[model samples]
Target: MANDFPFFKKQSNNWVYTLLLLPLWLVLYLNLQIIADFLIDDLLQLQNGNHLTEALRFFIFETPKVLLLLILIIFLVGIIRSYFTPEKTRKILGNKSLFTGNILASLLGIVTPFCSCSAIPLFLGFVEAGIPLGVTFSFLIAAPMINEVALVLLIGLFGWKVAIIYIGTGLLIAIFAGWILGKLKLERYVADWVYKVQIGQSEEEEKLKFSERIGGGYAAVKEIVGKIWIYILIGIAVGAGAHGYVPEDYLGTLLGRGNWYGVPLAILIGIPMYSNAAGIIPIVSVLIEKGVSLGTALAFMMSVIALSLPEVIILKKVLKWPLIAFFIGIVTSGILVVGFLFNVIM
Candidate 1:
């Protein structure tokens, strides 16, 4: 429908059209709270202090706001990512030393936006490009774990301090994990198919015009938001339930810093679950407010996003069981350490 409209279609490639939409974006972003208040406070008569009502209202309010943020951020990120495809990333890392490549790959993962589902292709691409095993691991770990969606959502919900901690710890995990794997000489564990398969190259890819980049951004919003909106709703729903109804003491005792088991328990629970950062951060916010330790909750959140069961299954095409197990073990140990250290210190 938007494609049929001249103004909307033109916005895809035109800076003027893009600028014109800012007012609309600003209006929607600013007024989501007002709309939530009307629905929860006025229409539903949900008083502020009531737990159930507060939970429902929190869900109602956060769902759209988070979605809106996701759409906008993902749109811009999509544009950024368009410039740094797996092929380009492999090329960039091909010439660097392992230490430098690992560092750069970890940073690139923030902007590249490759999810775990793409692990096989990305691994193959890097290997084919003659990139180092440890550097590849660095990119793989950082790509999903330190993604912009998680960072932005964390900042929005818990403020910059928590977001920064998550980023710093996540990057450290990626860098050291890759470096360790590099030291271990695990290249023999990669699947045979990866070595045999050839990804054919095309003519030099043409650069997209600014307008086309803008169009890519809009396309990204449609694709990403369409896919993840349901997850966002489910996350918000869980968060609301926790916010309004869960007993603070129960949460504190179970996930609070004082409980030695809290960190591992959180990680254990998070592994089987599947959710992106956009879906999980709201729940983290509720948990923290209910007295869950920041480290424990962040650990849980990272496990859900970074080490999901689905991701492991997907990676089976490229990595053998031994290699996968090693990867998981190393990363999990790091996460546990991070949780305990943060819990003890902060």
Candidate 2:
């Protein structure tokens, strides 16, 4: 009866079935806090003020909360993404000039269906499609760094103002970083084989029906949720531990605006790590709660999601050492500026 099934989708009953599921989902989501409270306070009867009990309750509450939010958003994003394929994205970026291309590509990166894990292929796709190198870089940076999962978590946890700041600064970073990398004219630095393997554009999405789009959404939930659900649990667990136990003074002294080195140091620590926004945002919230500055926490989150060691290693498959370094350097510089600027402003 699910919308993802093509046969059910072909029938008029598909929408009705989907509508039935909606209220059930709403009930679960709306009463999540109540349910978590029931398990901890009523069922288990754990002592309220105890650190371990509090941590357990935090984890129990946040794990399902984050996952439910992620599933719904990712599913919706997937349906929206069905309209924008790699081929379609390439065509849109193709023939666009430098500045315009970077803007368009960065915006497109949000709706396009690719992640850090698929960076190399997306880069190659853009390259073979004759998109500008800088523009391609823009898409690469924005696609993972300012992704939906991160954006949603930010909005849910930090409110609209912070979410807007994140999006604006993230877009700026992507746009300008790609622009800087483009000005360097580093096309020659790409691996030689990338140039040799020219690919023709395939006409895949001339049209899609509504049910097909719904199926696309279902597939997205399966693929992205399956990959990141464990990370969400792990991240929330780490966050819960911090929320219950980490001393305020340490986080404040280490990442407070008073600490000039906080932003850069946070980035440095984050670059070696690997976690998506879904995994890292909980930690971000904990940092902010524990007295860390938003800018430093954001810098840490950005570095992990956007410039991780693994992503850089993957880029090495296509980019020579110099280009990879420049990519890192330019993006890091942007993140640093954003961190420092925001620390002063907010």
For model 1, the local distance difference test gives 0.82
Each candidate's lDDT (Cα)? 0.82, 0.84
Those runs of model 2 whose alpha carbons end farther than 4 Å from true positions after fitting are: 1-13, 34-61, 201-203, 238-246, 249-251
Q: Estimate each model's TM-score.
A: 0.85, 0.86
Runs with alpha carbons beyond 4 Å of true place in candidate 1? 1-8, 11-13, 27-61, 237-246, 249-251, 282-286
Q: For residue 153, what is the lDDT in candidate 1? A: 77
Model 2 RMSD in Å is 3.2
Q: After superposition, how far is residue 94 of candidate 2 from its true place, in Å?
A: 0.6
Q: Which residue pairs overlap in candidate 1's backbone?
A: 13-211
**What lDDT does candidate 2 reach at residue 58?**
81
